[model samples]
Target chain A: MTDTDSTTTGPLGPDDITADSPFTLPGFFDALAEGRLVAARCTECDTQMLPPRPACYGCGSRAVTLSEQPRTGEVISYTSVNRPPSAFEHLAPITVAVVELDSSARLTGRVEASLEDVAIGDRVELRIDDPETVDIDPDFDLSYEEEWPAHVFELL
Target chain B: MSTAHLIAVGSSPLGKTDLPGRDLFSKALAEAFEELPDPADVVDGLYVGAQSERYENQIMQGTLMAEWAGLRNVPAERVEACAAAGALALKNAVRDVRAGVHDAVLACGVEKMTAGGTEGATNALGAAFERALEQRSGITAPATYALLARRYLHETDATERDLAKIAVKNHRNAADNPRAMFQQAVDIETAMDAPDVAPPLKLYDCAPVTDGAAAVVVANDEVAAELQRRSDAVRVAGIGSAANNLAVAERDLTFVEGANVAASTAYEDAGVDAADVDVAEVHDAFTVCEALLAEAAEFAPKGRGIETVEDPEDRSAGWTDVRINTSGGLKARGHPIGATGLLQAVEAYEQLTGRAGERQVADADTALLINEGGVADAHTVATVLTATDGGA
Candidate 1:
């Protein structure tokens, strides 16, 4: 019952959920730019939220901290986007996965692997959205240079 | 402890049409006022639901519909929560009556999805998602729910066949409805053979892009006592609404937590349980929706919700046996966004009064409706309706 390791930012966070923004897929880009996958963890109940959150999904607490996530996760479910939206027309036939992390929380990211190789329980490691393999939507015309995150996963 | 009473229910044909949004809304409103007791029962308030204001190029729809539908200069407002807009609009009007603010109120909704092409409508609807994950990643409505459908089968051992059964059942039910878009019954074989829109979700598995309107008139208990046509009114027993984090990945995919909260609140307010719901009109934009919502409404247990919907080949154990979606649901009856909620109200009124033709649930005493906004984009409104004489 000695739960006083609240200040440590390594896995178990010490910041409040409200103090810093939860990484909504759009908001997560800042951290991703620095090569980190962070999640918002409830400071009070120790619940973690991937794609970050304003409140804890486990205990409904607003006292959450944005903490870095483990690099590994298991595939929960996946689909091949044979027909993608117009924004991603160039990236048609992308592979998507709902990856549940070993540490805490689940997130959806594109999986770069053979469709036959990926299974429900297969493990995958986080990979950055590299331009070589990653095809981004055309944002050539815009007032603001928007960064649409395309976080990917490599089959373990 | 008095609840609002539904004095009249009205809807027009549910299908693709060239009618302007105002005209569609007015048509349903006019149909609703057909049996008004008297001019003295003036509509003092108007609430309209339209999911995509941009689609119609019309804003201030509540005011416009109120004027075009024959009532002008009354308090009016428009509400939107994607597919749940109509349900919420009805709830707002019901609340107006409940709050003792107006003797009678009109709640209505309309959507003209066909006016815009399929791509245009899809984009308009996509405005309802959490832009961060869903839109940014190219996940559309059907695809989003497909995630749930995929996860449901994963957890429950249910098959795509189970989902097909729901589509078949709804199509069968819609065949009896003249106002329904697709009145011809769809067989399980046809549903199974339809092209997949998203993996695990066939084209038949999704509610089509429809255009229609529906309206309901509600009055306070005191106003109900004086109405000329009060004999057939159904009491608005209870209403509950709640939402979850808009992030789809973080939430429990198997369970619709928001519907659970909303339905629980509505049940408590209505002083009834799942057993008391003789019929239910749920927001089944996709087949998986009907499965998840059945569980949220407590029509079935956590793991067994899909079992409530029988195999398409077997009618004995189908959802109709339990009287769910006796109106064919969003699947076959058609889903016209804002109008769908009031369409549920219309169906519930018809069944409760024993006026439903072929799709009627025999001796239906109470009804439950679950109208949802977007794919768990965080809003759910649950309403329970009953015959005036049925409950305390």
Candidate 2:
């Protein structure tokens, strides 16, 4: 598995890369690798942010740190783009969704796998894709665990 | 505050123009001023609305316009607020006159978007987005609207066909509007099948990047009455503005909260409801925006705006009772950012005064104009104009 193989599966090119390439946040990526999730907490505002920003969107203060998040959260909303922008032309019919982190912040990312299992308020977990071994970038290749613990949905 | 009436409104034909922003604005201002009985001596103050100084690398637009339009040395002020810059300038000018600070004022909005290349113009317009996040995410205005359109489709029963109707209707209306940038009418098939710029949104769904300006002279009752004695005058019944979070992620992506708030404030101030509005000129920067705005402004219920348009009564044709975007809106009229809000006002005045010609709604007595700036619903201005004089 190499970057080229990942490109065959995901959306990326030789020059296409993420802001975070060589450096990877383990706690963030490891959780996804283990089918869990994580986010960053602003020490000042106590606000949680996903796709983690270095600083707080609320307080604008740089006093922020990372935290492991629960695997399960409600899907606040979702949208399926039949046609993506030029940048994402290779990845059409992509489902972009916002999952409300239990602590308050919301995580926006692509929802891979089947659309039938996904619904607003459905519980989902982080699912990571190994891009280094493949041709795609891990950040763009990551997805969500569609099968939820029965209790997660039954509890609601 | 004393009442201020929009006595005169004017604009250069909107399109791809070789003229500079200042020159375009000056031409519109000249037309507006010349419409006044005593053009040379009437204006007591001038207000100019501009979204960015980076585009032209200049500031103090009102002073420049004042000088260029031959109304030199008048007190001039510039207002900036994403796309709603023009409406904000008008509000400030109206405030001055209503406060009796200035008997008469000229409010103008101008943007030379095409002067800069597409990328440069996009960068300038995208400045309204949350700098750190949007820049990192690389979400341009179209992308932001695309996200909304996706959400809208997900939550509602509306289809691509419904959104295409908005484009078709606006373009058809634009065909009759001499000032519209794209006067060519497009059918639903052309709009729906157009090439996609963003997912679920096509080229026809978006507004053009235009260089244009719109100007209006607002005056107090005394001045308005004097102007009325000589010519027809359109009165401003109410004005309202609202602000919201600048990031699309921060907002309820399903709704434009800022537009809702602005509409409530304007309707309340005007002592009327959405039903009273005979015609509307809304900020339809994108087709989905127009649909979402129709709901947000209380013209229709949530998730039912598509139904409203589909309803025979809600059609854009005459006798529809409530005509929305008769001037083609931003889609066909062009989105000259800074000038859009003031252009809405101009449209309202034209409709109320029965000067919209082929696109005029029959017996249009009250009109509503909505202008929004930024991707995150940052700023919204909603104004209600009535045929009746505000002075009385």
The most accurate candidate by TM-score is 1
Alpha-carbon runs more than 4 Å astray in model 1 = A1-27, A113-117, A130-145, B37-41, B311-321, B389-392
lDDT of 1 by residue, B66-141 (tens): 7776676678889998889999998998888888888788889989988878767877887887665456566678
List TM-scores for all candidates, in order: 0.90, 0.77
Candidate 2, which segments miss by more than 4 Å at Cα?
A: A1-99, A107-156, B37-40, B307-320, B389-392
DockQ of every model listed? 0.40, 0.08
**Residue pair clashes in candidate 1:** A16-A64, A17-A64
Tell me how far the alpha carbon of residue B323 in candidate 1 is from the true structure, in angstroms, after superposition.
0.5
DockQ for candidate 2, C-alpha atoms: 0.08
Question: TM-score of the candidate numbered 1?
Answer: 0.90
Residue-wise lDDT of candidate 1 within A1-156, one digit each (tens)? 111234333232445323223334444666675677777777778887766666666786776666778889898877666666656667766677778888757877777875557778898998876433455555521233255345678999
State, as a TM-score between 0 and 1, how close model 2 is to the true structure.
0.77
